[model samples]
Target: MPDAENTLLLVDDRPDNLFVLRMVLAEYLPDCRLITANSAEEGLTLAGRQRFDGALIDMQMSRMDGIEMCRRLKQEAGTAIIPVILMTAHHAPADLRARGLEAGADDFIERPIDNVELVARIRTMLRIKHAEDRLRAGNSELERQVAKQTAMFREYWKAVENSRDPFAIIDRGHRYSLVNDAWLKLYAIERTEVLGRPVAEVHGDEYFDAQIRLSLDSCLTGESVQYEQSFSRNGERPQQLQARLMPIAGEGGGIDGVVITLRDVTREREIERMKDEFISIAAHELNTPLAVIQGYAELLRDEPWTAPYKRTQRQEFLSLILEKCARLQKIVDDLLDLSRVDSGWMLVLHKSRWRVRDELDRQVWQFQRETLKHRFEVACDLSCGEVSADRGKIGQVIENLLGNAVKYSPRGGLIRVQAEVEGNVLRVTVADQGIGMTPEQAGRAFEKFYRADTLDTAIGGLGLGLAISRSIIEAHGGWIWLESEVGKGTRAHFTLPLMPAGTEVAIPNEMSDLKIAGEEKP
Candidate 1:
């Protein structure tokens, strides 16, 4: 009579009692299966194995009385909620029937051996069993649906909290229901001050109403609004943020709430402003020097009057113009390199294999020619070993190091360059016996526009050489460093991975020809 078959546990001590009840109950409860136990212990064992829809027990038994057994069954969990019907003899008296009911029995049937009454009671219990089972099944189904929904909401909430950007959900009444940790952190506010309360009550009516009206209008129309805003908090710097507000829909396509996301853009906006300022300063520096050079050169050219006066005056003026031009060119180059590195457009190499000794020899020769008076030395433990690196980039790194060695050192100081293979990397060091830097100066030697203490303070250039050198070396998965004692000397050191012999290193595209032909004549 139910949607599924019901299992019944019948306990009795007498073999005759068990056999008669099984035959009678089998015909009456056709849809139910009967499990008969000879003793109360066996009945409990069966109940432990599987769930039973209902249980029946005889009043009198050899080992345990049915009333005590019923009490124990009710005490045991898993079987505690199952309905029980106690069967007894007609002569058992009204006090005994009251005793059975006191032992957690739902109902009792007197045993008169009346076939009709026994069948009728069994049917009545089966009907009650079906109704109880349906109620339990309904409760369990409802609980399962609730659990599934709760799990889904938990996962969505976790995602919102884990997101890097700020996010929140506001109900139709402009009340905050869900705000992730990032959203709270961004505002530097607490949940208790905002949640379950109208936005106007928490943040003020004017500000809250304006934002809510805009967001709700956009969201309900299935549109999204994105814009930037700035606000000051607790006397700190005004924080800038980019915000996006979108509508969240409920079941049946009705607008439920608005989802707002805010991303911090303060750092990005600051960097952009700094870039514009740098460009303005650089233009002023460049144009002023060029204008001076142009004015002096024109005066010397037009006033070439007396031969001796003209040659001497013109040459001295020409030298000054050339020197300033060289300084201006160096500034322009440094600016270009900075732009390339900052924009992430600089060259990067992968698995470049180079001949360390050959690369160092070429660099030494180039520097020797550039600084004709300065003596350069190259000492290599492994003259023919191969080193893995970007050939052009590493060469530029070496050139910057050696050039700095020549520039900072006295005209005749010793500049020694060396390279050797150590473990899986090739270590290169360029040591110059020149004026060295103090600990404070060495600390910021690789910083942009940084310069160390030198005997001559009139050196011409923005100090981006070492900074660019460090950037290039680090981009190749290597490190560059410098060691110096204030007055002793400075040694620049760097490393590159050593490849197996016979690997070819690719040249970088940033290298260009420095044509002395176009430069002013000496």
Candidate 2:
């Protein structure tokens, strides 16, 4: 006997029929087990006792036919997958094969089974069973993978919705497939309306659409793009927003869509603008005072004798030259202070207690002598005796306001300086009946180097006064604002705290350098 243990069953009612088939099978498969039973019930009972690799059942059995036995085996879940071959005599009805197949028979062998044909049929059915086993295992694995991926995607979507930053994913066709709460809120769009909608169409405006379209195309090509976009819609204040588009990978490692992120960066933009203005100041604004000093110095140095000027005239020329030099020095100091102030750092303060009145009086007296056109008034109720501040910086702020009052009141009207203690804060206001400012001008007045249009272009000062003033005040824990009417005048008001309760202020050194007396007059 050849060595093998694969079991095969044969069922037949006649002894000679079972013997003949057993001899033929043994010749071809000497090592395999071929069990034979005389009745359908006996074959079914054998099947219940052990597993069989294959079964060939005679179609016509005395008590139970091959179809009935095949049907019963197929109905049970445990044996339904076993391969069954129906064997029939030539006298069996022509339709017996078809009837056997319908009852779950896998194949048929004509009566007086050919050893060669029977062998071929048995091998074919075994191969089919093997293939079906592999297919069922593969299907199970595929289903598991699908369920795992579904769970991951559900968790990812929840995170996207809950995030604070604006997030969205658009497909290769640039349609919104996912959007976070921040995205919907920032765009003012409804979820039902935005999903599946084209991105450019939703943005609507030409400029924003153009920006987004370009980035979308780049992201689809697998490039990450980051940029700043300025937005101003309706009467809203202009905003600077930073945006990023990152490529999302898909099937076959190809770019599928983009995950977009946007955030507000207006304050950063302002700092950038100030840096640019600083460069402008160094490159160009320095020339104005240089030109003045050069002209007057040359006049006093070379042409004084030829002009036969009076004694007072010669002194005046020198004074003008000194003033211009001081103005140039002040420009340098203001730039340095601003660079420090705008940086996200401490505003290096030397706070000291002093009477607000004395500071304003000195600034007003100096302005009275400097300008002959504008009449200035000072009303200080020292009811708020001492305030804590960088005296030199505060003096510079007051000087700037008084200077602007005289400079823009080109028509020379009353410039009023008033200081009074309001609760814990002492309020100081400088009002000028000069050519004031438009609403837009006043709004940006405190920005670096922003000059109002109403002021004469010939006025000789860089536009750093209000910006520097605001930075100084805020650094000292105060705020400054300006109220202006187009043709009427501007009232620039600022407040400082009287020394905090129980804290003594150091006696401030009158560091009368450029931060104080030499600030650009508006």
Could you tell me every candidate's TM-score relative to the true structure?
0.57, 0.58
Off by over 4 Å in 1: 2-4, 14-20, 45-51, 91-94, 113-117, 134-152, 209-212, 220-223, 232-240, 251-253, 265-471, 475-522
Best-performing candidate as measured by lDDT:
2
Please report, as a residue range, the 10-residue window in candidate 2 with the lowest summed lDDT.
509-518
Per-residue lDDT tens digits of candidate 1, residues 1-522? 761477888899998998998898777766778899999888888888898878889988878888888988889888877678888887788888888888898878777666787667666776887787789899899999999999998998888889988898888888898898898887688998889988778778887666556766677678888888887778988878888888888899988888898988987886575455445556766887899799987887677456435567778888889978986886777677766766667354644555678888898987777676678888888443776666776777887888788877765578999877677666788999887887667766776544453223444445678878766666654567778886678888877655553444333334322112123311
Tens digits of per-residue lDDT, candidate 2, 1-522, equal 122646788898989988988898788878878889889999889888888777888888877888999999898877787899998887677677778878999988887667899887887787787678678789989999989999998898888778777898899888998899988887687999889988767886585466788888888998999998886667688878899999999899999889898888987776776666556556666887789889988877786555677889889988888887897888888777766655644455666778777788788888888778888888888486777777887898898888788888898989999988787777888999988887767877776656554233546566778877777776565657888887899899887766653332322222111222123221
Pairs in steric clash, model 2: none
For model 1, which pairs clash? Answer: 352-389
Question: Candidate 2, which segments miss by more than 4 Å at Cα?
Answer: 1-166, 200-218, 225-243, 263-274, 300-314, 343-354, 386-390, 438-443, 449-460, 500-522
Clashes of 2: 0
lDDT, residue 88, model 2: 81
TM-score for candidate 1, please give it.
0.57
